[model samples]
Target: EIVAAVESVLAPQRAGRLAGRKVLVTAGPTHEPIDPVRYIANRSSGRQGFAIAAAAAEEGADVVLVSGPVSLADPPGVNVVRVETAREMMAAVESALPVDAAVMTAAVADWRTEADSGHKIKKDGSGRPPALVLVENPDILATLGHHPSARPKLLVGFAAETDDLIANARAKLDRKGCDWIVANDVNPETGNMGGAFNTVRIVSRAGIEEWPRLAKEDVARRLVGRIADHFAGA
Candidate 1:
């Protein structure tokens, strides 16, 4: 209901700007299992990416959403692919590629336990805590952005940061080889990470587009509209 109302105001009534275009969007926090009973995850709720999927669909694009373990319902008119770990998400994204554009908002865990126990680790009388070894996870964003054969024309990444947001986003653009970066302050105090509203700055080689705080649905609509422009001008 809330998403519908918000889209009413922001989304175009009938825009086919992205007609026949294929867009891929990744959303939510991927959980990396440490053990049979434990895992690592973040605070992402998947609202933003779902909204983007909805908005893209509204623009007449064929949208494929590769999502993490989010509780939210799948957006209408979009094909959704569910995943639990960063590796799974990476694979799903790759399989859905050859897309016209991509928006990666999944808070993929940077590291995962090097070896997860087949069985839950039991606490023995050993007073010492079990030492956990972690290894860096696959860099999905970078991999897709730099994919020579299947790279999307426009690859967008999200940088979740607490400080020096713009600087970090700019660096991410180069590091990830993405065309644009949506940098947002996710400080819990700001209530943006898992919140309904967002205040984001779009960073690209062209410059920065500082958007005002808006409902996540609104942000999605605007971003999708921009994506339409990107393809139209291409």
Candidate 2:
């Protein structure tokens, strides 16, 4: 009762922090085709990205969610653009540019077939597996990070790693030229991927801030608070 009362009083103040601000978020896993019927994809579930969109909306930010294949419904009050491959995701990002902030949470594939077969590859009597030629996909985060005109004031990229999480995230921040990087250990043994909860760290030029394990929604809300504070200071 007391918590609700306090929240009710603070709600307006919180909501107004991001009023008139525009934000972009990318989520889920891009599927890169190998053939007409087969593709390669990652394990992202898009839960964290959806939660971030909801949190930004709660703070009164006009949010655009560019999503890969996921079963989740669109976050209320967010404009969602659904897509498949990494190239498609990049196009969507370009279309929604000139925002105050951008969050890249999508597990975009690193490589895709150079030329996808028109039809599914079939094995002949030789009984040998088909060989696939792969080419690197566009680096959406790096593109926005280094963009001259379309870069947002605040750019946040994510690094889901299996080992040396902090070091790798810091490296990613420097390499991608983003202001911040949210790093998490997504080892299947930890069940962070496709799981309800997450434990993560926020890496920036200032330093790293580690967070305890919590629901994906909680993480989103906290991140939104920081973003709001960032704008307040600006």
Candidate 3:
């Protein structure tokens, strides 16, 4: 049954379309520590990114996954590097160089505490909440897209938005210097942020392609297929 399932999952790509391509993927939410026991993070389950990685692997790409803190098993035939903080994630990604494509799927924390207290901070008798200093984290997508060395030929980034989805996604694609931006509305009612299904638009310099709502795994397969087509045409 397991073998049959695997065959069904990969049957569409029996042509070995991406046979020897190298792809890198980032997943999960970076945990920014405030203290020994406290941290800040986003609501990314890493399922979408993991699914993409698996699809790419099944298409015959040599895959490298630089994942943030997530409790998931590594997919078969893919290299997995587990990391926690944003800084660590960035470092791991930079080290895994010279790939054909990169997918920035991780919902990285935009900011982190400026001063990470090594010791646990305790409340004083004043009954007032303590203040926190915030610092911006490096935009991993922008960093990799504009890297001086070993920049991937095709770079993809995700734009999770609540309003002005297409406009904001276009802006991000321009700002981040990535080849493609996958935009999705993550309104709480839509249940997209950590849900099994998604509805998204793929924005590029050419134009926007609105994809149908589908399971995350299906989305991954379609995106991987597009990536394979991109390389073939390039």
Candidate 4:
């Protein structure tokens, strides 16, 4: 009992398989500004990503959570960096680089206004709407996956698709050059986008491993366990 107590006191976080490892997580929905008053955003509540960060931290991993605009509280034992736009999120993710693993779960807007309007535009009684040119946002996951020197050892990407779920995930795994892709259906009917429960599948070179519908927290724990297994050569 004395020895155990002493060990616990000394290495409280070292009891898990991910001890001494660093993990990166990106979460929430990046808002791309159209004007000073409005921006393009998604329905992502950042629940799954936050849960993943918490799970990773619980497993003794040094977790860096680069989150977008979200109302979620910072997970205990995690270094949280909050950003509003996709560019900002990309910068934050890059700054936390050289991690052992990364999970890109943030729902980043695909495009943004080419230029932010300094002020909100008012209707001039014309029947036509304003024309806002848009440009593609930086692809954070693909950038890291194709990084020349700083790619994570185990890069994982998430695919939240409404259709062609497995096919899209497989394509993303190849296109993103990531080790694994976690695919889920967010077809509005599934309620997985901003809900507490999730159903996901692990898509990898090995094959697909489907998981039962579970609470977001449980999904996070199981995913972290899989990550630990991969590191431990299970």
Candidate 5:
């Protein structure tokens, strides 16, 4: 007990690459409810994002991870905030401002029903399905990208695309105004959405850096290395 206490006291003095930096990460898929019983969501297991958070925390950054509904356990040495919808995610992200970096990895729903039904939606005897009106949800990345102030020094976004990967990532970099984008192919065949391995490209204004397929944990480590290099030079 005495040795453990001594080690704990001295641990904070260890100089890590991101020791004093603060980082914010968003993970998982937001649920857009249609009614009390049903919701719309994308394919996401939250593994990659959780891996990234774990990696960042390993480097000693003060990390805040905002996540949607997921079964994964929280990463060690990180502060986690749970959320359900895109709007709640936006709010949680905004509240964790003034960080050195922000990673938007959540697969947020683009549109939500104009009005969610309070009760379960059921079919009547008419054999006609109920119509749902959808409206655009808040653009979390864009909001942070164009934030008047309190924007993080490094803003990273993720793009899961089925086609035109680089082109789409480039467009998103400009449209969302983020510093970097981690692009990946999530086609059903690729199996990246919920798989253990991932193939990704790091897209920035400078150019694209293609990384060979790797385990989700290795990808996280490599990304954290890049982040450390970025701060080392900054």
Candidate 6:
């Protein structure tokens, strides 16, 4: 009932905009395990992606949220699929095919343990730490963007950079072949990368557009509005 009330309130703002659309969104930081007790991951809290899923659902879209390991509760009317590793995330996303659009917001690990130790390795007190081998994980954004079949009409990727936000984002836009790239500086001072608030730039073939700092919810709403506009034109 509470969810319905909130949806009713948002309906005035989003009615007929995204109705019947199917939107796929990925969220959070993937965990790459080294051993049973050790792993590597990022600081992403998945707030932005979750906000996007919520906003899209509010706009009447059928939303599928493929999330990395996070504690966030699923949004109302959103189908949630939880994953831990980058490979798992990619597989889950591939299985949820034929969507109208997709947003790759998860901070996927670039590398993973070459060989994960099933058992925890104990310190031998040999005064030397064990060497860890790493292998690159598949780039989900690039794969989905360049998929030959079942490709979403519109695909979006997030580029979280500490510096050269625009340049790096533009380069990623070309490399990932996505329709839009959302770039944000993850500098600790800005708190836009993993914090509740975010300031991002949207890069497309047309050009770049900077958005003011706002709560993640607002950013999601604005982005979804843009998606609605594009879909309407298409």
The model with the greatest lDDT is: 4
User: Which ten residues in a row are the worst by lDDT in model 6?
Assistant: 9-18
Point out where model 5 deviates above 4 Å: 1-14
Query: What does the lDDT come to for candidate 3?
Result: 0.92
lDDT of 1 by residue, 1-234 (tens): 999999987875545888778999999999989888999898799999999999999888899999999899988889999999999998999999899999999999999899978789877788888888999999999998889899999999999999999999999999999999999889888898788999999999999999999999999999998888888785
Residue-level lDDT of model 4, residues 1-234, one tens digit each, is: 999999887885566889989999999999988888988887699999999999999999999999998999999999999999999999999999889999999999989999999899777789788888999999999999999999999999999999999999999999999999999999998888889999999999999999999999999999999999999989
- Give the true-structure RMSD of model 1: 7.1
Measured with C-alpha atoms, the lDDT of residue 174 in candidate 1 is 97
Clashing pairs in 6: none
lDDT head-to-head 4 vs 6, winner: 4
TM-score of each: 0.92, 0.92, 0.92, 0.94, 0.93, 0.92
- Candidate 5 residue lDDT tens string, 173-224: 9999999999989988988889999999999999999999999999999998
Q: Is candidate 4 or candidate 5 better by lDDT?
A: 4
Instruction: Report lDDT (CA) for all predictions.
Output: 0.92, 0.92, 0.92, 0.94, 0.92, 0.92
Q: How many residue pairs clash per model?
A: 0, 0, 0, 0, 0, 0
Model 1 CA deviation exceeding 4 Å by range: 1-15
Q: List the residue pairs that clash in candidate 1.
A: none
The ten-residue window of minimal lDDT in model 5 covers 8-17
The Cα error of candidate 6 at residue 112, in Å, is: 0.4
Per-prediction CA RMSD (Å): 7.1, 6.0, 6.0, 3.0, 3.2, 5.3
User: lDDT by residue for model 2 over 1-234, one digit each (tens)?
Assistant: 999999887765435578889999999999998888889998899999999999999889999999999999999999999999999999999999999999899999999999878888888779887778889999999999999888899999999999999889988998999999999889989888999999999999999899999999999999989998998894
Q: How many clashes (backbone atoms < 3 Å, residues ≥3 apart in a chain or on different chains) does model 4 have?
A: 0
